[model samples]
Target: MTNFPNPDENHASARAGWEHIFRGGDIPPRYRSLAEPNPQVVEWADTLPAGGLLLDVGCGVGRHVVYLGGRGFRIAGIDISPTGIRMSQEISAQRQIPFEGHVSPMTALPWPAITFDGALSTSAIHHQRRADLVQALAEVWRVLKPGAVFIADFPSTDTLDYQDMRTRVAAGQLTEVEPNTFVDESTSPDPMEDLFLPHHYCDAADLRDLLRHFEIVRLQADLRPVTTAQGSGKVGKWVVWARRPMTT
Candidate 1:
């Protein structure tokens, strides 16, 4: 918290740092499984049709971007961190994955309506607050074509494992630098550190409520077992699946 920007500015820095870490392969061990396809990824991979636009939100290090691009889907990604975007770009180049990465927030994507055929976001939504979440969902709606698939997974209030991380960090044990704080407004950028939004943790029921805008094709909670690295607790991880409705 030293030499930190304003809360708003600090927030942006937090995001930027994550982007840098994502590219640098410095992702906290708790979140560094870019290779292992999570359950949400499994569902997304199964639903993705061949040769269509796939938007990879929060594309850390471009792992999925490279994979999906190789699968014949045109790809693009958005992330709050510049380092992440840069890393994705480098990885894309090194692996010959044809895709673009935008260093910006998903709430204000630089794309037009019906821009994608399929979309995926795994283990990265809790970084947004409720308002940001709604904005992000709206952006998804705006960019996704009718009947296109959209998948996302995030933390819920029931996700006490993350809470343990914070407690342990305070006690000087966990490797995580800090517990991302939820705030009223977005944070600003700091050259040294990044800011993030651990804004909302919607339970299954709560997610259902916010997902009213979408068709909500399906929903899953606590599907994966929480590892000791993630947290030593009974609460498991959560994920959700949804679809944009076809226009009548």
Candidate 2:
């Protein structure tokens, strides 16, 4: 059996680490590249009703909020890091893109039930442990209207980082909090790579199990080459397009 950190401790640690990273304002170049809207998200969102209200879960720095808002969507974003929310608001202001932003965790969205017409998350929900991920998805479900379109991405276990972390955990160099969940303890001169937090990886089976409540429209790997200041490699992500059921 694998040992896991106390749930409360794990959550607190992740929140603090992200807060520190965002507060430093030295975001890595790789992350900076993410300021642009994801093409897949844009394509999926194009199907949404024009000018409909949308919610962005874990909207780090509001990349999607700003981009989608500019495209004429009424968008709001939420993140656990106050600095992230503040920076997103500042950027939106600078660009004159009107959007709402709030500081909160994905597991506990501040919005009322069925308040959004559509919702999305990118590269964010996988930051939690399995249980927390479930709660966060439930919160997303709670806020979305019946039959609302929802899309999100999860880190794939096939990624090089996941393989490296598996090797490290086997060598006892890193702790495996759960089956595919790990506490990132590796050090890096690059502040971007220095994030110390829990990273959860998933596969197709995991996604199917986790999203059983939704009507899955698409489930496929989002493969792309990524170059960072430290090195270059490919990242494999499981991008899922799902819809909230029309009832219950």
Candidate 3:
């Protein structure tokens, strides 16, 4: 998510960082698995009626798009990288999966209101600044049909790694330009370059505020082990599955 170039010039540094990261041709193994829909995502999507329109926000290289579109879902994907969008389009064509891919920022999605029956913003969202995150979530809420489902994940502040990061920031070992937001720099000898990108980690209160427009069905922390260039440890991730209230 941090890899997305911010539309505003104030985030020029962040944009440069992201552009450099995406310039690499190597596709991480973790992302390769995304070429197929996650079982959890499939389970959630199955609940929707047939012919539902689904969106893949921050869809890098169109993995989810190919998987979901091949299954007959009318799929659309958006990403900040032109290469990602191009790759996505190429993959969709190769797989013969009908899809539309756009190069756009998640904060400013180019879609009409109530346009999607379901949406998935996976492994994204955390890259945004506070205001951008707010805008992105609002856009998600706006584009989703009433009673539609949306699932997303972001980093969580309720973790040891978060505390460690904060401690480093407190000691001036790293920079926190915005509250709970980190900029590019790491204490690790060989930090995961991407980890240094701008990231906003949130707490439960933050999640509640972000999801206020929707009826939250599930909100939980995913404690998964991850290693940065600095060290190896577990970081908590926040997963939210929610629905737009029918009355709204």
Whole-model lDDT per candidate? 0.68, 0.81, 0.77
Candidate 1 residue 177 Cα shift, in angstroms, is: 18
lDDT of 1 by residue, 1-248 (tens): 57433445534754855755564443354343447556566657766777788898888777788778767788999888776777778878887878878977767888889999988887665565555666778888789999987888766555565575456456644334223434322243232322233445556777787778788877766644455765454565556677888863
Give lDDT tens digits, candidate 2, residues 154-184.
8888777777788878886777877798875
* lDDT (Cα, tens digit) per residue for candidate 3, span 1-248: 56653457534544454455455534244443445566568778778778789999888767688778877899998888776777788888888888888878887788999999999987767786788888888999999999999998878886766877788788877688778987646444223336556678988898999889999998978787777876777776888898999986
Clash number for candidate 2: 0
Best by lDDT: 2
For candidate 1, what is the lDDT? 0.68
Question: Least accurate stretch of 10 residues (summed lDDT) in model 2?
Answer: 186-195
TM-score between candidate 3 and the true structure: 0.84
Native-structure RMSD, model 2? 3.4
User: What's model 2's TM-score?
Assistant: 0.87
For every model shown, what is its TM-score relative to the native structure? 0.75, 0.87, 0.84
RMSD of 3: 4.7
lDDT score for residue 3 of model 2: 65
lDDT of the structure predicted as candidate 3: 0.77
